[model samples]
Target: MQDVRAGLISAFHWRSDPPVWPEHRIYYADDSAWWREPTILGELGSSLAALFSDEPPTVVMSPESRGSLLGPLVATHLGIGFAEVRKGAERASDDEVWLRRRTPPDYRDRHLEMAVRRSVLRTGDRVLFVDDWAATGAQAMACQQLAGDAGASWVGAAVIVDGLENSADRRLLMLRSLLHLRDLRRR
Candidate 1:
């Protein structure tokens, strides 16, 4: 875990320019470095997998884009299947049920649709949601809703970095991450 944390910290890049939102004045942590190297991703996946080892997950679900990358790696390490939540209605199948999700401003601040084949997620299956990062947790909440719709049990959520501030809702969910935003903030 220490090695993975060190690698991520060393590879992380803090942007000099502030975000459009004044509240987000701290530089954004560039995540490309972690995605570029297989070793780093594997280490992250391994660490994430370890979090749920006691109660292994039956399926790993992730949203489109970065989640598509890290989710599979974690599933591979855990020897489980992976399911993808498509980004839009266009990618959804006519036969599948589409769940619409609203993301916070930090994550494009738009509504996105996600779906999983009914056959892919079965009832009673334990699901672990994986993503590269979580700030306001809009995406994770959507994924959880997706799991709920499918009747799968949400085991928890795992991510590379967590940026959410303390909140009552967050306290109710089991969210694990290798690093927090404070860990990467420019000091």
Candidate 2:
């Protein structure tokens, strides 16, 4: 993960001309935190599928953020079910599955909020988390907390890129970006 994080910081740029953002505000709250390249996203999805090829995952819990788009692609490639974590809404008593989200200070929401949705994970269930990028691990940890609360076993996080130094290093089962600073600097 350390190598992956260094590669991400060196290769990717947050500021791009003409700006590519999603129609939904939740995904791209700010230009600083989203991955907009379609090719990269596709590659990331494929990479995620490859990681689990040995024992292909069965269910994927995607963050309600930008990663949702890529998560489905990965899930489809792996032939699994995809569950989204939606923010600012309450699910029915039976439907409610609580997940914590540690939003960065600049996040549009301006505060931490828990995403609630229909429970897709049952006690002792194995689940994977998919996200576009990871900077501080807050979001990932939050998801872990939610998964723990729901009695689901956390498989790990798969991301397009991770900027935090050593963020993914030593993580038992995480997959990250293929490009590093050297790769991005040339592009």
Candidate 3:
């Protein structure tokens, strides 16, 4: 995990003027490069897999965009199915369900809607939510709600970076990350 964290830290870039939110000055870590490389993705998947080894998930869910990339890789490594929660105006079929939540203006500062197909997630299924990063944990909370609505249980969350100050207060789900906000900020 330390090696993975080091790699991520070295690869990550920080900027004050983020495209989505320019007012806030913070350490921004771009995960696109890591997602594109198979070896890096595999290593990330392996680390997350080890974190969730004790509690294997039946299904892995991720929010659209970055989550879409990491979720599938982790799910594939764990031999589980991957489900995506669409953001924005994406529509789901009649059988699909949508879960919406309001996120703090930390990153995008907007309302986000996540959807999952009813057929893909079953009741009593253990789900692990995956994402590239978590700042305020608004998105992860929304994902947890989506899982609950689908009658699935949230096992935990796995991410490359954990930026939440009060991770325990976010929810009952355990969170595992390779790097943290402080780690990046210190750099």
Per-model C-alpha lDDT, please? 0.79, 0.58, 0.76
Give the 10-residue window scoring lowest on summed lDDT in candidate 2: 25-34
Each candidate: RMSD: 3.0, 7.7, 3.6
Q: Model 1, 92: alpha-carbon shift in Å? A: 6.6
- Which segments of candidate 2 are over 4 A away from where they belong? 1-44, 92-111, 166-175, 180-183
Each candidate's clash count: 0, 5, 0
Question: Which tens-of-lDDT digit does each residue in 1-187 have in candidate 3?
Answer: 7777777777666655554666555655566667666666668877877777889899999888888878887898999899887766354456545554444444667766656766677799999989888887878887788788878899998887887888473455588878777777544
Worst 10 residues of 1 by lDDT: 97-106
- Candidate numbers, best TM-score first, in rank order: 1, 3, 2
- Model 2 gets an lDDT of 0.58
Q: Considering only N, C-alpha and C atoms within 3 Å, which residue pairs clash in candidate 2?
A: 1-168, 1-169, 7-180, 10-181, 11-181
Report residue 53 deviation for candidate 3 (angstroms). Answer: 1.2
Q: What does candidate 1's lDDT look like per residue over 51-167, in tens digits? A: 777778999988888988888889999889998877664534467555555444446576655656667777888999898888778778877877888788999989888887866
TM-score (C-alpha, index-matched) for candidate 1: 0.86
Model 3 weakest lDDT span, ten residues long: 96-105
lDDT of 3 at 5: 73
